[model samples]
Target: MTMRNCTLFYSFANYGLNKKGRRTGKATLIHSLRLKEQLELKQKYLNKSHELMRTKNEINVEWDSSLSHANLLDTPCGMVPLDTFTQAQRQQLLLDVVEPPLLSTVNTSDFGKIKSRAKYKLSDWIKNDSFCDAGIAFIKEILASEDVVNVQHSIYQFNLFDMKRKSQRTEQLVSYINAHNTLIDKPKTLNFTNFQEVLFKIPIVNGIGTDIVSGKEMMQTMKEFIVHFYPDYPIKLMLLHDDERLAHENTGAHVHAFISGQNALTGKYDLRIAQIKKVNEFLFKRDGMSATLFSETGRLNYEQAGDVAKHMQEMFYEFVNEHLFHPKNINAAFHPESVRKSEKRKQMRKEAKLAKRDRPFNYHTRLLEDVDSLEIKAKKLDDKISQREKVVDDLESKAAYLSENCETLIIKRDALEQQCIKQEAAFQQNQRRHSKKIRLEQEVDERLSTKRKEEKKLDESILLKQQKHTELDSAIAEKQSILDRLSVMATQALYPIQKMLEHMNNRLILKGRAGAAEFMQHIIKAFSADLPTELRKTLIKITNNTGDTELENALTRKDSQINDSFDM
Candidate 1:
């Protein structure tokens, strides 16, 4: 597919030591006016459009202009002319338009400080001398330093291009850098110490066939291109769809991409724009997309920055008034209707004032009979006055009696109040005693409950121990039974060997010398056959003469005993 044609505009602004970056004191004024204009425009649109008026309560068109600045003029008032505004408004305007404030030193007090302190409008502290000096030094340092030759060395070494691709979401990229005025979604205060801003204009054009490229698509394509080419840099992107003057008067969008010239890893301001442009151009050609690239680099002074800010604000409001609140759009149709309504109301008020001014006055002329009537009325009034004097005297006596009764009633009320106070004190004392008694009873109940829980636990422990003792006793009895069985088995196993020994002794006594000799020979033969040859030879040497002599003598004694027993 043939890609969309685009343009890239690159520019940079240094924040230096100023926390406000390119934003000036005038930015405050422009910002306030922008908010007020937006509110007024939206209100005007709602008034004329019937559809909008139906859901007017649901619409959120309010702009908050409240400021911490003490001066009322510092706060935003919608669309009021400078000449018609109050004194406070005039002071606020001057504060923003004035030059950068001077620095306070030991030798000299800054003129701006004196004015601001007296008025309590020291909100422009960001434009002080220290900021200006640091900014100038930073610029000089950048210029004096040598151009970075091997800017791509680290990019290749770290293999940033091979890293996992980041999300195309613009918010993630914007979180890393301050975008300043390019971001129109919300008011962002520029507070970076040292930074650079770059702009890219990309016009959506028709591709092959009837496929038309949209502004958003163009913006996204440009974003991906930049991010892919400069993957290692801290870059941010913002798309401005309202900028219509691009690619030879064709209505198109522009992109603002801010890249920190500072190294992403080291945070050192060593990166140069040459490497960026080279990669951007190569990528554009490689992708077979028509693109143009341009760059501008510099630091803006206070007056210049203020002028630029004011100009930008003027453009912004013009765009908002013309395009955002266009007459053809239903949302913006209420403005004219509201204006007409206001004029009609004003005309009605004017006509009512004119009608009152033109009305005729009545003339009064008195006759003779009228004078006679007045004299008769005066006499009647005097008679009534005399009767009223009598009534007043009676009223004075009645008031005196009522005053005396009121004092007596007040004395009675005081006595009742004293009795009430005594009753209240007695009731409070009884309540306290009852509460104390209840508390002591609760404590006693808690102690009894705790004792019962402890007794239960001890009883359970003793039961468990007794169960274990019974198990141990049963195991000991079982072991004693097993030992008795083993003793019986051992006695039965030894009976046969004892009987064989007794038989051998009886043979030696009954058979005399021959039996003893035959036993000795059998013993020798058993040792030779069953024993190892070496052990058998050792036994023969040990028992050769001594064993035979002992056996024969023992046999002879046994034979003689038998003979003696027979002769007896």
Candidate 2:
């Protein structure tokens, strides 16, 4: 695959897929160009406005951290001046600018992967920041330079001779022939001169469940077999890779090359190399970028290892012939050095981008300060609201009390109105009774006056009648004296009686007013109004004088006649 430059895509901004299955590159490009110009214009206007957005920051200065100190070239989080952004531009700073990086290193790896991840903690740990100028200068110089060499380690071993017992001569001979042909590849002659001797261990170790082939038993068998069968010679050891985790338990196996130990079945042997079967199987295998191949048991293996070498001679041959060598020019691309170099350049570019991100404006710090101030003001407002509510409640209670008092006054007014009405009715009845009593008293006084006038007239008339009677008596006495002397002259006495009556009448003329009938008429008028019967009888008796029979008779007759009228 070839790497394509993506700078042209940014020119269109987003060359979206169209309905015709082509990129709408030209249309979008014109639109994006116009939008960019508009954004730039808006940003210019924004810068003029903010001039000074912050009214105060001194009270909230302690809330800021060490990063708040801004370099002119560094972006100091959200504490930047408001002039840096417009309404739309501000949204971009939060959603796009503050986001994490796209090519950042992952923290975990899959199985069999062999790359160093860019973990910050690991980098901190390995940061060799000593004041050692010599070591530091050397490392810096190496990093600045281009060419370098890499190194690795391996080992080999072989066998010396063959042996057989009398009873199993055929099986031992055949075993010796097969082992010599496979491991000890040499001249095809059946004689001992054609065989060669070296050392190697039988079992491969590490990442296996158990060790079935004992190195000690094999080493002892090989050593004794060599001394008895071939005698008086030495063998060297070989290794495929250097691994310290293996148990070089025996003194002779301490070096990763040769492992000399006793064999259980064979009495003795000399293992000249730690080149186990796992170390030799890489002869015809293919390996990948992470160095993947098969182990001794034919499962896959990876990273920092190759095939085993059991003998010095065989170990040397396998290295030269098993892998393709002798270089010829094919292509300059896809080389391991080239790939690694490009990865380094990518990391350098990312570091430069981060430097650009640390610009001179940030908005988070300003936002935090404003929020703190708002919270303080809100608390003060809450206290004022509580005080006003209490005052309103007191006013409502007073209004309720006043309303109740008004109702009580209305009841008292109604009662007073009822009392006034009853008194007026009583006064009207008393006035009517008093008017009737006055009329009755006036009638009684008129009756008393009339009775007194009638009595005065009746008493004068009675006195005149009494004087006339007295004169008539005196004249009669004078005539009687003369008649005695004239007894002798009798006839002449009758004639003198007439003359005496005339003289008595003339002498009996009395004083006082006349008209008794007029007096009686006035009495009747005065006493016509009803009076007590006892008072009426007393008036008659006073006017007639003491016990006058004529008057008493008249009174008795009047009483008797009035009683008779009652019966009728």
Best candidate, lDDT = 1
lDDT of 2 by residue, 346-434 (tens): 57434433311121212233333333443344334333433543343343334323322322223222322332243234324434224
Question: TM-score of the candidate numbered 2?
Answer: 0.13
Estimate the lDDT of model 2: 0.29
Tens digit of per-residue lDDT, candidate 1, span 494-552: 22222222333333333333466566544433332223244334333333323234544
Query: Number of backbone collisions per candidate, in order?
Result: 3, 56
CA lDDT of 148 in candidate 2? 26
Top candidate, metric TM-score: 1
TM-scores for all candidates?
0.20, 0.13
Q: Whole-model Cα lDDT per candidate?
A: 0.34, 0.29
